[model samples]
Target: MTTPAAPARRVPEAVHRRRWVILGVLMLSLLIVVLDNSILNVAIKTISTPAPTGLGATQSELEWAINSYTLVFAGLLFTAGLLGDRLGRKKVLIGGLAVFGIGSALAAFSGSPAELIGFRAVMGLGAAFVMPATLAVLMNVFERDEQPKAIGIWTGGVGLAIAIGPITGGVLLDHFWWGSVFLVNVPIVLFAVALMLWLVPDSRDPKPGRIDPLGVVLSVTGLVLLVYGIIKGGRLADFTDATVLSTVGAGLAVLAVFVVVEKRSDHPSIDVTYFRSKVFSAAIAAVALVFFALMGVTFFAVFYIQSVRGYSPLDTGLLLLPLAATQMIFAPRARLLVDRFGHRATTTGGLVMLAATLAAFALLDADTPIWFLEVVFFLMGTGMAHVMTPVSVVIMQALPREKAGSASALSNTFRQVGGALGIAVLGSVLSAAYRTDIEDELGLLPPGARHAAGESIEATLAAADRLGARGEALVGEAGDAFLHAMHVTALWGAGVAVAGAIVTALFLPGRTPASEGGDRNQELAPAAER
Candidate 1:
């Protein structure tokens, strides 16, 4: 007779009792990672200014500062998750927090744009380990029935970071130099580390797979090459450049090889077979596409509010309050909608709402009422809350409890990769469009400066400033160019969101019978496994 299978492990009662507190600690850890990005958004203009006030970095350099963090975070997340599963999550969490704190300190004192970008990558390495570990530990501590509720609350923490990051950065900018925004993270990291050591318990997979070093190398290499090419294309505003084509083509080729290698590996970092389920694949795709649309739109929205409308950083942050408020209000409650309408209807509806909000950007101009933009932001946040909560539940619930680390890693990797691409692609679109519209007006500057001025609205404005009273006409022209570019990028974002809606409607499951109840694990299992 075959040997009996081992019984499932149970969560300790003491651990169960303090699960909420553990979640609170995990959120605290998550806050600093996300907070850094949001704070950077509000400070981008200051960072683009000349020395003393800012770094004097160009728009392309600024995009690299953001994408460097995201690309590293995206590329290493799967491997980091596997490490957490093999070792202990608490150990990894502490280690990651320490690294992030060190990176933040180094980044705060960076003397140049290149140094800042390099330091941001170090922070990304730490964030890769922290993000998946939080969700994985939560999965282990909570019962399956409670996982959805726990994940919803976890998703809401992202909104909390979004709420706090910009306003905090604005306040810091008002009083201190731009570096203060990064410096603020050090104290929060220290506090979070203390709380994690005290409250969060260690957890890991009982039978972890071997480390796939080759797979890790291939994935990171491919992603960096791919993102570098995309960013380069954006900087040149020419996707057809010989260098762009070669790098993008090579990146795609390597990633294809990675897929083939993983398919044949006995102990892959990511189990490629799990994606056989249509529902699982669709859910992950939805996460990626929605972020792709939203992140791209947000990249331009900051400039539109600050540079075009002439709002101070603090005012811009306050204006964004509606976005964060609606997310916090609706994120946890999204589960109610999922229970009533099912993931298919809920996610599809949310994407539709998101698409509408993105398209509404076309209606905005320098003179539009501020309240009108706030309403759009509010609705956009509501839609995002619904989509994120339900899809996170779907992705996390699809895997076995033992594979929670991998599950969380896969979900987050796609989200980060999507966001990174969005910023690169849409930022390029905005750049190209702005250049096309403003090139004629740039004739007032020297030929050497005209190309640089045409690169971005900020660059244009800086060039115009040096011209004194003679540059007043160029300022009005720059605003018009940026608004036109924003309109074009918004429509592109809306189109991508609509594509996500269609994918969800076609592949995500409809309502299940009441008899099935909370047994979503079995329901979402791959057909091959069944």
Candidate 2:
């Protein structure tokens, strides 16, 4: 009699060993992309430590360093995916690695904020090409049947990159300069270029139609204005400020026009009607909400670590280990969970977990021990890992095989939108909280101390350290208030997560996982299908 154990054992035995090698190549390539994200956060203070080009850079420049890459990559994703289909995935992927390498080189030696932002934008452009290509190439290489396992591994790699980046960045910055963060990417990209050249096959959409240039213009402009207003909201007095409102309005209008252009294009950058498909739309929506909450936690948590909690760069990164680790550990399990629970249920549950995790984060305080935060961070990461990988699967499975690139691009675009809005919405909440509290305290102080009070949490802390007087401890009081405001912001983040959970739960179907052994849907979300 054949037992279940034999089938399980035979399945592993039949698996092509060479696929793991290809996976190794894919993982390294992807690691360079995601690692660039968290590593920069670690390098922020270190990079601006001494002020290389002139004197210390303005706070806006600091914001640009991170946002420049995020905005460009998000904006250009659709075009990059289309270009890959036109040019060939492997060729574009290889070229992107080279371009990314060059951008990293430039970033490593950038003398000014302008140079840094420009190079980072170049990096973003490279990343846009790389992101879609990685999944598409993997989709092409793995047969219809073997995709879920491969994707799970691939998603795990993303989680690993995320988890390890801060620690790696911290270690690098300790031994080398902040430039080391960018410098690190050079070797990795070089390695990826070589590995991809040797291992990956050249593939693209076979009968691709026209390329949409106008759509590209509109999407880029829209994302830039949207993200700019978001990141810069704190420096401004009003959200309704004419420039901010106008920029956001133009962005939306351009994107609206772009949508019309694509729907009519012989070769549309994206299939606008994909929203009509339940799986595709639901998958993207879930990711959008999930990442929205994640950004709120990650972005401001970093601020909390360095400014309010007073952790050093290395310490802050180490503190984030739980966050990354949670994502990594759960990514592989996400596939099995989804396999059993079905897509809608799995994703919705993930959303609930994410919301709960963020709600837990709201309980953290200046006096909260790091150990407690570590556990909470781990839970947050686990929930997020599940939410991301699974939803990605649903989107991929719902689309035509030839349309994976464009489908992936749109899914990612939603993620960027969610992240940008999270930053804007949650960040604005924090700013208002911070400004109001500080202003209230400053009103009691003499005019001389008001400027110091109006400064950021970091500046206030620096001032408090230098002041050393009991009566004139304006900076100290401001620092406390800063921590308080950040705490309130965490509550706002939790609220966003709750909203996301409800939306996901409401729309996502509660079906039992279908036993489509070699289903294309499973292949769609590379990480989630695992």
Candidate 3:
């Protein structure tokens, strides 16, 4: 041999012992990001109440508040991942935490809806950096054999956030101002910052490459425009609207341009060819579809429990706890199932379970029993746990550790886009059905009240409350209308989940012991070595 290749260095014993502690810090970061979104969702009603204390935002403005965060977060994710890879993961993580805390502080004191929306976008920027860094750090810290267990634990923390966020927001709203939801992130961010500094190590790409500024511009513009179009279309229920069509068309065009550009670049921002791997493509699709169905169901479920069933926010949160509980319980166990039965079986089985749950939910009416709701909620959680956890593990295995930041950001981007589309499409379906049902019933109300009643369930209930006996009658009619809408939405979600199940079955590669690291290692080596 011309020269002997050096043996790979062993990880220090100290690092092995501290890796679990490092994971705790990473999860803390993940939890804050997850909780920020969930808490904002639960706090929307309080924040949008009539002025003096609340901001008095319109329906469109409220949607903007949520969508602004999601759009900005999604758009910046790829750039954020690249930054973390080039500049040191721990450094980016800390900077993100600081920026996030500042955004939260500003958001808490915002005097108007516009101010809050802008600040939320700032938080999104910070979240973009944090999300990728956490997963990248995990990858660098853990060896391949240990990744499944670590990922299981990481996903469990995400499940716990889902369980806690609504309840926490509900409790805060019951006793405090709506701004308390934003303020809560401050302390958590501080704690995570401190812990990460002490426990986590800095890591970066071995061979840093030039940043592709044009790629960043193209990706961000494409995502923001696409999401904006979807949100506007869903709210209006008019896909043919000139503004929506133009915006979405432009977004698609830019994304196509981005694909061509990435193909030609020597060091592309994202390697589009990664989709060539069956496992990689399947995991991304599974995540997107699963989230699409899940988000649609949850969006309506909150309204069903609170408006139709007449539960308090706290009570509603408690009612939804079963969903989170089952997810948490089964997430870790999903890895065990993967070890025993293989990823294909577990993933498809989970999808089938979710489809069945959605189908059963489609049959429920306003008078459906609470016990039935609880059972299905738990079952939905179980199905999601099985599907999401294994899919995440497979995604991690499909990509090389060196590309972890980009891969993680790519996975998260699909999830956000899927969730946004789900809310838009399913919401449009629900809105169309509800408006049709309510239109016939609204003729009995005062002309002024009729328009308000037709707008939304909340507005309908408020209008009814003002009308006394007429209001009571209207409430019953509105509840029935909402139930009908819920049924239609559930059916659509069921169909999506079934389609996802079939796709999962067809696209997800069969597992064999030799296939896990072998192919990915061979494919990733050239770039990784550079």
Runs of candidate 3 exceeding 4 Å displacement: 1-10, 52-54, 444-453, 513-530
Give per-model CA RMSD. Answer: 3.5, 4.5, 3.8
Model 3: per-residue lDDT, tens digit, 280-316?
Answer: 7788888988888887787778778878887766777
TM-scores of the models, in the order given:
0.97, 0.89, 0.91
Off by over 4 Å in 2: 1-17, 48-59, 440-455, 463-472, 513-530
lDDT of each: 0.89, 0.72, 0.79
TM-score of 1: 0.97
User: Clashing residue pairs, candidate 2?
Assistant: 151-526, 335-530, 389-528, 392-525, 393-525, 397-521
Higher-lDDT candidate among 2 and 3?
3
Ranked by TM-score from best down, the candidates are 1, 3, 2
lDDT of 1 by residue, 389-503 (tens): 9999989988889889999999999999889888888888898889889999998899898888988899999999999999999999999999999999999999999999999
TM-score winner, 1 or 3: 1
**How accurate locally is residue 51 in candidate 3, as Cα lDDT from 0 to 100?**
62
Q: Candidate 2 lDDT, tens digit per residue, 1-530?
A: 86556323212232344567777887888899889888877666555443551224334555666667877788778788777777898888898788888899999888877888889989988888888888877766666556666777778887889888999988987677677788899989988898887876677788664677777777778777776775455655357778878777777787788788877887666666667555566677777777677765676687778766778778888989888887788887788887777666777777777777676766776778888888888888888877877777666566555666776677777886677667666666666567667776555445786554454555454445455564256656665776777778777777776776666667654554366534545443443322
Scored by TM-score, the top model is 1
- Model 1's C-alpha root-mean-square deviation from the true structure amounts to 3.5
